[model samples]
Target: MQTRRTFLKTSGCLAAGALLAPNLAKAAKVKDIGIQLYTVRKEMLEDATGTLKKLAKIGYKQLESARSDKGNFYGLQPKEIKKIAGDLGMTVRSGHVHIDKDWQRSIDMAAEAGQTYLVCSSLPSEGQTVANYQRCADAFSKAAEACKKANLVFGYHNHEYEFDKVDGKVLYDILLDRTDPTLVKMEMDLGWVIVTGNDPLAYFKKYPGRFPLWHLKDMDKAKKESTEFGKGQINVKQMLQNMDKSGVKYFFVEQEEYPKTALESAKYDYDYLARLDY
Candidate 1:
């Protein structure tokens, strides 16, 4: 039987020794591993095609692109990026972008890229009051409607600031309570939730099935920066155990600031996740 590993070993693109010994088919291993391209943005900026090939080699089966100075796909058109990733045996499931006046264009690009979700990276307007969040919720609902027209789901990715209090209520809760769950899905960033003194498990309990996407980042407790999986304060293994409760369908590995080279950190994360059983 010429398995994928055997084929890769025979083809010379993959070294037999470098492969992770545990097969993904093993029970309890995460079925689909993904990475947010931002983790390797520098490499992409230098050589997008080369970077993607490296990621595919690293065993990232799915990707979520981050908007860069070059363009949404490091200057590659939507269809171009889609084709490139397809050839590499990976899929781009989602991306981060601002909900702005050109949002319609963003929708068009996501549709062209053959992505399932288009996430608003942050609040389009400024103001942390309840009224502001309500207004943003209204806007996001509208944005979701537009995304539906393009056959895409609309979502939001959170940072630490969303946890800040607006009056007596948590601003993030406002966004959740106000938005129509069917229209707006939240991409909870687990690391930010922990670093800011919030509990992701509680959110799962509070808003069951509201989060469909995730940025599974690990954070350093003291430095509050991203660290290699096990070295960080975050309990990556424990979080994976609760994926069902969080309603996560697609989670991407996101490391913002790492101690080693970005690609090295990414590789370490890849191995750590591959070893995880939940």
Candidate 2:
């Protein structure tokens, strides 16, 4: 999405400057930056309201929730989550859910939460074969159509396993080819893609505008665990520069293996994205 010229105004120094310095900060930024609730799972589980308020203060204005043991919305009702975030100048944008037999309830809950997208956090079926992937695709189509009727979008988030070679073919790519791009959108996890020895840019090129959501994570290349933003191997700036090709509307920063407290790591991640230009 093209950013408004006025939105480019930022504040920092010149040589090392990143703000209002249009020359330094350059064009477009991820306005309404978001975070996956899973990143702050511990804090959320402890105090959902307080934790959300803290994220809002750090300038993360959008959210993507995960299905937690405490239940969706971290023990709060769907409307309560929406109300709380809205009270803090943030929005509940998307959520990670399982598209299982209780999917209709998920759709209902997501709609009630006032979020735009309901993402299947993992594959519904349990096999890695082409037939299995195809079956998943068909199921996804049906699920997405149901979402369409409810005025919502349905998508899937990938782990490294999706890119594994099956019958000499990339299973993730096969699903992409098999599904209707309009119906079943994808939420590309950059860290997983990179860790799996795949190129996210290649996917963008092959399937332009197919991805609308992303998990913006940085992984410790050596350990394959998530770390603070700039401390990892993901070329975040490069990816941001080419975001248009990926058709990204919103991306949620996620870090599972933190160097410190989850909340502290979250704050570090928020600031990292804040200073970047692309």
Candidate 3:
């Protein structure tokens, strides 16, 4: 694996100002900057080739796949998408595989995509009760063990629902406590955490290093959905400052929908990260 400095140079994304600016005095050591492909689902489904090339040009060296409308890597199949990622000098870190009958196929797809991690972004709605939560946690524990055997990391993505109290304990707490930390990691979504009335920084502090991945998104202060990075309520700089201690490895910029074009939205995010000294 290339150092982030080398990767940035090779990807041709050294910010014009960063070219002259001194090294970030207190910058956290980030391993990779990725993009959640779901942010540009429309363009991806319509023009996978062109869209991917554009993302690569924008300095996205890794991708986190979302389930397509047709399911399975925007209808191109797993191996095909992997080839595209490789050709573009990008890696597919992980993908949101729907929990379904084809779950085994999803694992195979992850291998095909050359992904080191495979995640289930959501849990089934049916099994959300206290009893179900324990069972689900156990299931995830088993899955994590299986992933370890396969030489892959398995993780769960979070939303507000996890904060709901179950038997006097927050469901998220239960899941975290019960699951084997070594086997199952977390993918923190800062925006959703904020939306649900929790503090992102608090979690980063409390769960130092438990999160290996994150969905980099910003929440609109006045709006309900996601917006551009700096224009949102989330203090991303503060979040980044804590990442090193938080053990976050890779974070993917993800804007579900934006007022402007997806590329433009992503550029704004990149610019913000680049401008910050930390």
Predictions ranked by TM-score, top down?
Answer: 2, 1, 3
For each candidate in the order shown, give its overall lDDT on alpha carbons: 0.89, 0.90, 0.79
The residue-by-residue lDDT of candidate 3 on 92-123, one tens digit each, is 88888756677677777787777888887887
lDDT of residue 225 for candidate 2 = 92
Better of 2 and 3 by lDDT: 2
RMSD of 1: 10.4
Report the C-alpha lDDT of model 2 over 1-278, residue by residue, as the tens digit.
53565345432233346344676446765577899999999999999999999999999998999999988789999999999999999999999989887899889999999989999999999898999999999899999999988888999999989998987999998779998998899999999999999999999999998999999999988898988988989999888988889999999999998867898989999988888777
For candidate 1, report its TM-score. 0.89
lDDT of 1 by residue, 100-175 (tens): 8779998999999999999999898888788888899899999999999999999998888989996679999988
- Which stretches of candidate 1 lie above 4 Å from their native place? 1-27
Best by lDDT: 2
